[model samples]
Target: MFDKIRDVILEYVELPKESITPDTRFLADMHMNSLDIMTMIGQLEDEYDITIETEDLNNIYTMQQLVDYIEERL
Candidate 1:
């Protein structure tokens, strides 16, 4: 799941795959703004066949948090 999530993120960002760890922050570390985050979320929703609520996003900042949220929905 982590690998899949990383792949989805890779489609939007140019960073090396190795640098995207569970602790990497979408905002602070990857410098993803609102549009970038929403675009990535759309991809993820399509890839995982899950709907991620906007309110749920407030608590998610790191890669692991996103992974965990998707896992729980699945």
Candidate 2:
């Protein structure tokens, strides 16, 4: 699950793969704006065939958080 999430993040962002750690914050560490985040969420939804509730979006800040959320839903 981490590898899959990492792959999507690597494809979406310009950051080097090695730079992304579980602790990496989406905005602060990865340099992602709102649009980048939305796009990545969309891609994740498509990949998993699930919709991330709008309210849940607020809870996801770091790479670990996002991966954990998806893993829980799975």
Candidate 3:
């Protein structure tokens, strides 16, 4: 699941796989904009077949958080 999430995130960002850890920040570290985050979220929703609430987006700020969110839904 982590690998899949990483892959999905990579598609929208230019970060190296090595630099992307559980603590990597989507906005601060990756320098992602709102569009990138939204696109990543959309991809994650489709990939996991889950719905991510708009409010929940703010709570997910790291790779681990995103993975945990998906795991919880699954």
**lDDT (Cα atoms) of all candidates against the true structure:** 0.93, 0.87, 0.88
Q: Could you tell me how far off, in angstroms, the CA of residue 6 lies in candidate 2 after the best superposition?
A: 1.4
Task: Tell me the TM-score of each prediction against the true structure.
Answer: 0.94, 0.90, 0.94
Model 2: colliding residue pairs? none
lDDT of 1 by residue, 1-74 (tens): 99998988888889999999999999999988898899889989998899999989999999999999999999
* Model 3, residue 26: C-alpha shift (Å): 0.4
Best by TM-score: 1
Write candidate 2's Cα lDDT for 28-49 as tens digits: 8788888878888999999998
Error of 1 at 65 (Å): 0.4
Q: What TM-score does structure 2 among the candidates reach?
A: 0.90
C-alpha RMSD values across all candidates: 0.8, 1.0, 0.8
Sorted by TM-score, highest first, which candidate order results? 1, 3, 2
Clashes by residue pair, model 3: none
